[model samples]
Target: MSSAVATVPGAEHAGVSLLRGDGVITSYTPSSSTVSEVDRLQSTYREGPCVTALWDQHTVVVDDLVAEADRWPRFAPEAAARGILSMLSFQLFTRDDSLGALNLYSSVRKRFDLDSQMLGGLFASQAALVLAGAQESVRLHRALATRDVIGQAKGILIERFGVDAETAFTMLVHSSQNTNLKLVDVARWLVQGRDRPVSS
Candidate 1:
């Protein structure tokens, strides 16, 4: 993400973040304290060009945060207070399953013009590919971890209750459905419970 954003023509301070479905920032590049704070404010307040781009699944260009009061009522004022006069945000990946956004900020108003916008778009496309690879890696890691934990949980159930593998799995599923929790959470709970010190 950092490398992809670095090549942009005039982007002085750039940041990339992976946002969750509910608009929570999961991962981010701390380009600088100021840029980091700006990104934080956006996520904390749930308003900003980045947040808008994520929701609308399109590039959001704010030539001047001070002049964009009507667009982002809360964010524009706060961003201006932080000396962020201009910003450009591009949604990484497609609208259907957007991962997050790549954002560029400037202290000068109207800093991101037509040429800058074009370069930013090109940079964003490259960033999307990198983000997709990173997301897939995370997904694969989580899947493997879930599988391991579930296996451990099934083993514990089998040993403790003298049940077969299928029965142990069924018990886990039943617990999951009853508690309205994910199978992974249920399995994790079972494993943790098994590892706890037994009371006399």
Candidate 2:
């Protein structure tokens, strides 16, 4: 089913980026350092297909770069300066979770249309499968970090409340559950005032 969805040739020219837990695009499939530079420039300016894909959670097409000055003046100039003249981007997302964007860049205007958009959507769906796997990886990493934070918070709670480690963790978990928040969030809040520095 996913293969049928990804029949388009995005993997040939497209650059697929997977977002890290810190909300930065940590990796891309095409392995082009140029794409990351382009993405960084677009993100810095807050325009172009990259930002549009992340914001709208859908495909973004710049069918004409030289012709479309009124649309994105800031972005087009930078793209033109970098010898990029056209761009198409698709977000990898499910109903609630956004993974990242698959970006396609060209050196000419009017290189894509509605047909390309349909094809790009198909490519994005396929990209979402890989992104879902990346999400599982992120979940595992986050779980480990949360466990560490909980351990530190537990030490504080045990000392403050005169409770055992189990009781302290149960308290933190219960509070998180009751507040509809992640355990990491609760632990962070509890440890925010601590002298210990955070990695991020």
Candidate 3:
């Protein structure tokens, strides 16, 4: 974590935290107590930037807590509880799609400098690499599911169109290409009659 902050280059009095996959308060710099408290609140209430970051796998910022509206009502109270006036948080994401976050806070209202925010973002990037390992495990587990679904859809195509697996896959690919959609979308539609494949 110190190494990550050190590599950040421009942050002053930087505070960083690494969230657990479950959005728990895993660890952070001691000066980042508000962030730690917010993490605890998020874990306890299932709300705030930590939980939001995990869910959305993106950055979250509260520039000015006092002037800000009800963007995060529950988190607002939690911020008040922790004496936090401003914060910036980002999800530490893996390529395979699991999430965690790095949170930073300041006692002064809207006190964050742009460099600190970027530093926080950099922190998230490092944690994202760690998450990639977990995410790959998840991806491996889902490979079978993906293959099964595609395979089922391919079988449906073969039966319906009297084509071989290669031809069926080709047709699926052709349709996807023609309509600017993914092969999975075409396969999903083929498997389920009268259905449109919707992205999750």
Candidate 4:
């Protein structure tokens, strides 16, 4: 965010917005409290340059929020009241499913120019890659942890019930279905000794 403010002319503050897998929007690395407030407004209103860039276009440059009041009826007035007049937002992802947006804010009308847009776009691309990689790492780590727990659960079932590996797995699946719990949850329960006998 500091780099964005330094590199992008007329950008007084910067923040990153992320759309989580659960469909919630979150803010990260806000340059200041004012930037955080702006991001919160965007999330609450669901209508702003950052939201528009994330959902519709690759880039959204608002030279003056007052002039674009009709575009974002609820968000524009609120943001302007906070002393933000111009904004430049770039979609972080280039793919069909967007990750989020990188937003730059300014207090002066028509603050951002063509040069600012170009620089911000480049920064957004790099930020997108970093965010994607981090997300993938977290997913992989969770998958590995789940696999290990399930394996331990299967071992316990095999030893206790004198069943083969496949049979133990089937028993776990049956218990998951009977209880309407997730397979992972069933396995975790057995591993933790919360449940002894498999339903099947």
Candidate 5:
């Protein structure tokens, strides 16, 4: 994905960053020294075009870093020091459950024009699709694991208390609610607890 953006006419550097639902940057790609520095600054200070793009769910274009000093107090100066004169950040994905950004940087001001924005946006959409697919795969895997653990927990309850399946499930649910933990967590606890010897 970074390579795709790097091919843009005036693009000097490009990076794709994934942000967790809480707005913390989780991962980024194509490790260039300067680009990695910029990514780190944004994640550390929590300000920059990329951060804005992720939060607002839109593209953020900076024509000149020097001119945008007030907008991003700490980021603008640091980015300029690294010879980044301009940047374009597209919101790669923004859903209730996910967020991500694709950022392009250049040494010359106004490097990304309309055509570049459109092409970058297209790339961003592709990134979004990939992120969404990956997230879904993770969700499905967790769901399967949860089901397996919960089933084991239910079986244990049934054998120990001589209860029906529905009653055993209810017990799990009650435990989950009482502890304020997820049903899956509660079920996992029950399964692991069996390994411990009962106290005399």
Candidate 6:
């Protein structure tokens, strides 16, 4: 965001909008509190340059928010009142899904030009790639941790019940189903219990 504010012409503030796992769009890495408030307005109104860029178009450029009030009836007036006159947004995406948008805000009318768009687009693309890689790494790490805990649970079950690996796994599945809990939860419970010291 700091890089964007420094490099993008007329950009006073910058922010990343991301689609959360729960299907909500949220502001991330906002350059200032003003950017965060503007993003909140976008979420509340659901009609802004960032929303349009994320869902309908690859990019959105608003030269004058006051003049464009009709386009985004609820959001424009509110944003303009906050002293944000011009805005630029570029859709951020990966090969598999639409990630979110990169947004630039300016207090001057007609602040962003074609040059700004070009430079911001390049930055947005790089941001998308970095975000995608970070998300994938988190997923891989979570999967590995889950596997390790489940393996430990299986080992405990096999030793205590004098059963084979397959039987131990089946027992875990049955416990999960009977308790209406996630398989991982059941495995975690068993593993945690095994580590607790017995009462005298």
* lDDT tens digits by residue: candidate 6, 53-134: 8878999999999998789999999999999999999998733433589999999999999999999999999988887788
User: How many clashes in each structure?
Assistant: 0, 0, 0, 0, 0, 0
Query: How does model 2 fare in lDDT?
Result: 0.68
List the global CA lDDT of all models: 0.79, 0.68, 0.62, 0.88, 0.82, 0.87
Candidate 5: tens digits of C-alpha lDDT, residues 1-200: 45665556677888887777666675466436677888888888889998899887499989999988798999999999989998999987666766788888899999999988888888878877887888889999988988999999999888878889999999888877877888888888889975632111
Scored by TM-score, the top model is 4
Question: After superposition, which runs of candidate 3 have C-alpha atoms over 4 Å from their true positions?
Answer: 1-33, 94-98, 130-200
Error of 5 at 172 (Å): 1.1
Q: Global CA lDDT of candidate 6, please?
A: 0.87
Ranking by lDDT: 4, 6, 5, 1, 2, 3
Q: Is candidate 2 or candidate 5 better by TM-score?
A: 5
Point out where model 1 deviates above 4 Å.
1-6, 25-27, 94-99, 178-181, 193-200
Compared with the true structure, what per-residue lDDT tens digits does model 1 show for residues 1-200?
45534666556678876676655764477577777888888878878888888778578878889988887788889989988998888888643444678898888888888888888998888878877888789889999999999999889888988889999898889888887889888899889885642111
Candidate 4 C-alpha lDDT tens digits along 1-200 = 89999989999999999876655668888999998898889888889998899889989999999887899999999999999999999988744343678999999999988999889888888888888888778779999999998899899989998999999899989999999999999999988887556876
Q: How high is each candidate's TM-score?
A: 0.81, 0.62, 0.49, 0.92, 0.84, 0.88
lDDT of 4 at 100: 77
Ranking by TM-score: 4, 6, 5, 1, 2, 3
How many angstroms is residue 111 displaced in model 4 relative to the true structure, after the best TM-score fit?
1.2
Clash pairs for candidate 2: none
C-alpha RMSD of each candidate structure in angstroms: 3.8, 7.0, 10.0, 1.8, 3.1, 3.7
Which clashing pairs does model 1 show?
A: none
Task: Assess the local accuracy of residue 51 in candidate 2 as a C-alpha lDDT between 0 and 100.
Answer: 70
| Model 4 lDDT at residue 134 | 81
Model 4 reaches what TM-score against the true structure? Answer: 0.92
